[model samples]
Target: MSKGNIGVTTENIFPIIKKFLYSDHEIFLRELVSNAVDASQKMKTLSSVGEFNGELGELKVSISIDEKAKTLTISDRGVGMTAEEIEKYINQIAFSGAEEFVDKYKDDANAIIGHFGLGFYSSFMVAKKVNIITQSHKDGAKAVKWTCDGSPEYTLEEVEKEDRGTDIVLHIDEENENFLQKAEITTLLNKYCKFLPVPVVFGNKTEWKDGKEEETAEENQINDVAPLWTRTPSELKDEDYNQFYKDLYPMSEDPIFNIHLNVDYPFNLTGVLYFPKIKNNVEVQKNKIQLYSNQVFITDSVENIVPEFLTLLHGVIDSPDIPLNVSRSYLQADGNVKKISNHITKKVADRLAEIFKADRADFEAKWDSLKLFIGYGMLTEEKFYDKAQKFSLFKNTDGKYFTFDEYKDIIKENQTDKDDQLVYLYTTNVEEQHSFIEAAKNKGYDVLVMDGQLDNHFVNHLEQKFEKSRFVRVDSDVAEKLIPKESTLESQLSAGDKDDLTSVFSAQVPNGDKMNFIVAFEAMGKDSSPAIITQQEFMRRMKEMSAMQGGGGMNFYGEMPDSYQLVVNENHPIVERILADKNEAVGKEADSLRSKIESLNGKRQELEKAKEGKKEEEIEQAQKDELADVDKKISELNTKKTEVLSKFSTDNKLVSQLIDLALLSNNMLKGEALTKFVKRSIDLI
Candidate 1:
């Protein structure tokens, strides 16, 4: 027997290990179990290379809990350390046995998990004392028992006869007594050791016998030794992938498609990424991708490991290149991690292109659910955008799908404007914008459905990527102007006539505080609606994006009132009749006021032009007084003219009906205004 204090620079290392070595105290189980797995794998490697000539029977890692004794033991059938090996590896705090074994057997070792010697010290986190009983595979080697409390001191001595391997017995501390519970240990094993290369046995498998649970002869193996990600893609069937998905997430819906990643040259990376049917909310879908290192589950929040948008995917990513001690800053700075992320982005984009090329109809069928992911990627990752453009699709309001180039080809002839810009018409709500969509379709122009959660941002991205192109919502302008192929129609109404018409229509618009109506005349032909409402494309997009982004710098647009163009088609018969009726009712009064206002405005303009080059003091006082009087008289006449128009508009129910019809079409007429419109509509009928 021999006794000694652990070799260290300081005596405070154990306290740091107990308090801050790992973020979660439960991580101790993962570290210990992983060590056991490494030992079992080393034994297999030695036998495979003929280093060990003994019977290599049933290599497994077994975990057991003694509740009354308040102890848990993890045993393995693998390479065990001799007494001298224990003094060097265990007593020297930071010395790692697995690291040495891996360096020596780099070619044949099966997934050695421990790179940091600190994994063994993690046991001190939950245990008051730990004992190791190990027997090396070398012939005539004496078995040894090593004991250590939660300190630097330890004891090593010869032990009773036993099979070659190791047994790590942890005496649970009073504060962490929960580690001795069967259910608690079972859950920890399932989470951390569920996919270890060696089979992990917890206890005897149980079955119902005579309506009661009873232990069976078979041992309960908790892990799948060979997970789907570890195997070659050629060996897997669709059913096998699906079953693995179910095993990973029992309650989640089936995935739309999957990408199997396997690469070895620059850095080894292998895993399966599944494109799940993401919900409308991008936030709830994140943290679903589990990250692993050599089949050992590391974390679920892989935001640092993958690009931000790829967090929407679900499944597993295992890479030995990614270290177990993952800090956000480390992952961000690591060169290998960046390569892995870039590789994943390329793999996803290539897989999508392949699927689209293999079966376009099937791809189209799944586009509705797939666009959110693709759109998010395109908006956030430039590399992904470059690759995704080949497979990305545009869905029309007619339930038809087309690639970006294909849609451009279809619309180039008919939808290109006089400025040589291809206009991509789109609608957010099919039912609400039905009229606008129909108007566009009637003119042989196709409209896309840009209604996804990220469509607003994605449209902006596409504009930057697609040269000489723009996306215009169907309702952003009148059908005739949406994709202008010729010069705009000239309105025949005089400036004075337009002013009178503006007052008539603007007087009936609802909720001046929340909505602003800009009355304008457009010659949209006699077949068009007499009055149509449209919003400007730029302002509308800014406001939509502001709302989506929760209103940052673009909040200025969101805070402004909604401005709509109450476009009255000058060629429509109803508008012609309304103009005629307004002239008949208020023409005499309006004409007299306009003549007085025009004469006064001429005198005022002459005075303003005369004083243009002169300083304010140089201008004569009498001239200023006279100019002020002319402006006041002109303002009075304009007020009187506005009153006459207002009275005419109030008396004419046709004007109200036209304005309400425009509002109703835009889905903006709601609450009390909608109620009043319903009543007035019946009265007019």
Candidate 2:
């Protein structure tokens, strides 16, 4: 018998391993199971090289729990170390026996372990003492017993062992006595070794006998040995892939589509990423991707491994190439990780394109659920956008689908403005914007349904990507101004009449807002509605983004009362009738006021036009006095007109009804305004 200290230089190494080496103490299972897998792989290599001629019996690793004795043993039948090999491998710190073996069999080490090599020390994370009983396959070699008691020092002596294998026993630490529980051990095994290449046995299958559970002879193998992603695509059926998905996420809804990644070149990566049904709220369905290294689950927070938008995916990604520190929680931004990210993006895009090309009708059927994901990818990743443009679909109000070019061609003729910019009309809530959508549709124009959560951001992204293209909400403007292919309209009302209408509507409109509503008269057909509320694409987008970022500094527009344009279609029957019809007794009174307004307007216009050619200080005081008098006269006339309109408005329900209809169409006639409109609507019917 001989005893000596471990060959590590630092005495505080065990303490560091317990405290900071791993992001979580639970990683000890991954570290230990990985080491066992490493040992088994080494034996395979030795046998292939004709070094160990003994028959390699069952290579399954077994993890046994002896709660009565507070002992957890991990056993593997592999290249067990000889007495000499034990001295060099076990005694040395940071030097793994699997590393040397893998070096010799580099060609055969596909998923061979020893990448970290220091995984053995992880046992100290939970154990007060550890013991290893191992026998070499080599002839004339004796089995060795190596024991360590939570220290650098260890004892090694020849021991009687029945088989050529290794048994690792961990005496659970008093501080972490919870490891002695069967439920805890079962959970750790399920998380760590669920997809290891070699079969792993946990405990006996139990059945409820006599109202109590009893262990059966049949041991429960906790691992699948080979998962679906590890197999060739040709060898797998849809059920195999689906079953693997269920294994990964037992409670999630069936995935909308899946992208199978198998790459060996630039870097080795294999996994299945499923496109979940993002439904409506994409932000809520995140953090589902689980990253793995050599089948040992590392983490589900794979933001650095997968793109930010693709984090909505749920599945497994196993890549030995992803070099991890001891914790494996935080992945370093190395070349391999970058290569893997790029590879995954390419695979996802390729798979989507293939599915689209194979059966476009089926793809279209699934587009409502899949569109938000694709749109987000296109907006964030430039490369993803370039690939997605081929398959990214646009859904219209008529339940029709179009590709980028198809939609472009469909709207090029009538929807293009004078500047040759293509206008894409879209609706958010069909029910809320039904009037606007129907108005556009009535003109033989198609409207797109841009109601996804990301549509606000995606619409901004498309305007930047598509040349000479603009996306307009169906309610952004009146139907004619949306495309604006025609010239200006000739209004019968003069500029003064325009100002009178602007003041009346503007005063009645909502106020206390940074948003300003401009009232303009359009010579739309007589049947067109009396008023329309529209938003400028530029300012509204700024306000929408302001609500999301920076802060409420710009939130004046976000929080401020919504400013809507009370665009009175002057050519419409109601407005035209109001202008053409004499105000009866009110007409005579308005005419008398208008006569005074005309005389006052002449003096004000003359004074303003004269001052336009003169320098500011050069104008005489008498000219300023004349301008002030004109303004006073005009104020009196405007006051008189308001009194007349106020009296008419109280008596004329048409004015109130028209305003309510415009407000209702904009979905803004809320609270008392909504109640009054409802009552008035019933009364009118």
Candidate 3:
């Protein structure tokens, strides 16, 4: 027996490993299992090259948990270390200055493990003491037993072992006795080694017999030696891919499509990315893409490995190039990682384009499910946006799908405004905005269904990408003004009549604090609705985006009241009759006040013009007094005019009816207001 200290400059290596790596201490199982796999694979390689004459039978790694003894053991049948090899590989942790290394990276767990090769030493994180019994495959090699009790000191001695492999026994610490549980160990193995290259055995297979589960003689393997992603894409069928997806995510819906990536040039990368049917909630769909290093599962959170938008996809990405143990900061800064991300984005885009070109009908059939993911990618990654344009589709309200260029070409002749800008009309809700959609259709314009959760941001993105193009909601303006081809129609009402009409209609709008109604006259012909509510495109979009973003910088838009234009068609017969009836009821008094107000305004304007070039002292005190008097009389007359109009609007049911009709069309009239409208309609009938 030979006993010596681990060659480390500092004596606090074990405590440091336990303290700093406690957050990710669960990875100890992964590290040990991966080491066992490496040994098994090396044995296979040596035998293939005729370097070893021994039989490489049953290359498997088995995990056993002894709850009563509080020990977890991992045994492997592969090339193992002898006494001399153990001294060099396991005992000697060559640290130039251990104190300096710990000080620089004490806070970063991955940095410490990755900077120095600490795969074997990580067992100290969970185990109070660890023992390794290994036998080398070399002929006449003596088997060795190594023991360390969570310290730099260890003992190495020759031991009798029949098998040419290794057994790592971990005496789980008091605080980490959970590792001795069968369920806990199984879960850790399933998460870290489910797709490893070597078969991993946990315990015997079980059968539900005699009303309970009983162990069978067959060993239960927990990992697949060859997962679907490691095979050739041409050899796979649709059913095979689907089965694999079910295995990965048993509870999720079937994926829409998949892309098989196999690249070896710049870096070795192999994986299968599936386009899952994403819902409106983006947060729930993320973190489904599992990242692996040489089939050893590294993490499900692959945000650093893939673009933020691509995280919506679900699959397995295995690359030998990606370091298994490293900080996310390191992965994000690595040049090779950037290259891999770019390649993945390119491959995804190309695959989408291929699917679209091969079978457009099928692609169109799946557009509803695919649009959310495609829109996210286009909005985030510029390179993806450039490539996605070829296959990205625009779906119309009529359920017809068109490519960007195809839709642009079809609408360029008619949808282009007088400013030579293409106008893309869209509707958020097919039923709620049905009236607006029909009005747009009546004008020979096409409207898209932009109702996705990300459509608000995506619309802004499209505006920046497409030249001379704007997306307008169908309900944002009157159909004639949405894609204006001619000059706007002049209002037929006089200035006074317009004011009285606005006062009459604005008084009846519901929820004055929450909603703001701006009354304006538009000569949209007698066929148009008497009163229609329209929101400004830009303001509406800002509010929508603010609501989705949960209000940071855009919170200003969210806090403001909803503004809508109560567009009264001056050419409509109902509006003209309403004005005529109002004039008959209170026009005489309103006209007298207006005449007095106009005379006072003339006097006030003359006084203001007379003193335009004069200083305050130069102006006579009597002239300023007269100017003030004129302003007071004008203000009094305007107040009387407003009173007369308010009285007239209160008595007129037609005014309330028109305002309610517009509100009801916009789905804004509810509760008592709707009841009042129904009652008023019955009384008129």
Candidate 4:
């Protein structure tokens, strides 16, 4: 036996490894098993090159846990290290300066072990002592045994070993006794080695018999040597990919489609990405895309490797180009990783385009499920947006799908307003906004179903992308005003009459802290409802986007009360009769107050026009005071006119009934107000 200190500059290497690497000590199994796989693969390479004459038997890695002994052992049938090789690879942890090495690497423990050929030493993190017994494949080579007790000291000796492989025994520390359990070992092996290139064996297979699980003689292999991603895309069928998706996510719903990624030139990348049927929430479905390095699971959070939008996809991505152990900044800055990301984005876009061009019916059939993902990509990535626009579809309320250009061409001639701006009418809820949708259809206009969770932001994006185009919710404005082909019909009511009408309807609008209603008149023809509720498009969209984005910048808009325009249709018979009744009820008092208000307004208008181009001192203080007094009188007269109108309007059941009908159509009437409307309906009948 020959014993010497392990070639480490620092005496406290063991403690440093334990202290700093405790966060990721669980990956110790992956490192060990990966090393075993590397050895097995190297043996195959040597045999292929005629370097080794021996027959290469079954290559496998096995893990065993002894609870009583508090030891976990990993054995591999691969090229084992001899004494001299062990001295060079395992013992010598070369560093230029002891103190400097500790200072720099003490913080980045994972980087030190993963990138510095210190994989074997990572065993010290969980084990109190580690022993290696090995026999090299080289002819006449002596078997060796090496031992280290979590210190700089180690022992090396010639040993008797029957097998031409290696056995690593880890005496699990007191704090890490969990590793010395069969169930724990199996779980770790399944997680890190489930898709490893080498077959990994845990223990004997079990069968349920005699009311208990009984171990069988057959060894339980825990890994698949060849996973689906390693296969050729041509060999894979649609069901094959679907089955693989099920294997990856057993509980998730079936994905709409998948994109197989296989690139070779700039960097090696092979994986399958599935467009899962994501619900309204995108954040809940993230971290499902598992990233692998040479079939070994590295991480599920591939945000640094893939674009933020692509992270919503599910499945596996294996690329050897990305370093397994490096700083996040370094991984992000890697040229090959950037190329891989760009390639993936390109591949996804091309695949969607191909599907859209070849089998548009099928693509449209899946559009409801596919739109959320595409819209998300367009919103987040500019490059993806540039590509996605070709295939991104606009689904109309009539269940028809069209590309941006196709829809634009179809609506360009008719949907263009007086300003030559194309208007896109959309409905968030077909059922809730059914009346509004019907009103739009009656106007010979197409309305899109922009009801997706991301559609709020997507419409804003489309507004920026499509020249001279704007998206208007079907319920956001009266149909005639939504896409104004010509100037809208003006209300025939005088200013005083309009104010009285506004006061009449506005007083009956249901009270709520979350919403505000403004009374206005629209000539929507006699066929339209007496009253219709319409929210302003810009403010409504801002509120919607603020709710989705939840950003501080837009929170004010989100928190502000929702305001809607309560448009009274002037052409409707009910509104005409209501005005006639008001004119008879108020008699001549309204006319007298209106004439006096008009006289004051006429004087104030002249003073405002005279003062516009003049210096501030040129206007007397008395003139300014008179203007203020005139405005105050006008407001008081308007208030008196409203009081007269309210007395007549409030008593009229038809006024409240008309307002209730609009509220009911908007799905805003509820509780006592809805109950009162129902009771009022029965009484009227």
Best TM-score among the predictions, by candidate number: 1
TM-score to native of every candidate shown: 0.95, 0.91, 0.95, 0.92
- True-vs-predicted CA distance for residue 675, candidate 1, Å: 1.9
lDDT of 3 at 202: 98
Tens digit of lDDT per residue, candidate 4, span 1-685?
9999988778988797776643578778988887787677666766766778898999988889888888888899887988988887788873222223334434432111133456677788899999999999999999999999998889999989998889999999999888887788888888878999888989899999999999999999998888998899899899999998998898988999998888878787899999999887888999899888778888888887899889889999988678644211124467777788888888999999999899999999998888888898999989999999889998888899998889999988889999989998899999999999999898889989988988888888889988988989999988889988766566666766677788888778865798888898877777878899999998998898888777579998999899999999887888888888777877477778778888888988997997897788889898899888888888998888778777877888889899999999999989998998999999899
The global C-alpha lDDT for each of the candidates, from Candidate 1 onward, is: 0.88, 0.81, 0.86, 0.83
Pairs clashing within candidate 4: none
Write one digit per residue (lDDT tens) for candidate 2, span 430-487.
9988988988988878999988877888999999889999999888788877788775
Give the C-alpha lDDT of model 2.
Answer: 0.81
Segments of candidate 1 deviating more than 4 angstroms: 208-214, 326-332
Q: Rank the candidates by lDDT, best first.
A: 1, 3, 4, 2
- Candidate with top lDDT is 1
Q: Give the distance in Å from residue 74's predicted Cα in candidate 4 to where it truly belongs.
A: 0.6
* TM-score order of candidates, top first: 1, 3, 4, 2
Q: How many residue pairs clash in all the candidates, one count each? A: 0, 1, 0, 0
- 522-564 per-residue lDDT for model 3 (tens digits): 7787788999999999999999989988999999999999989
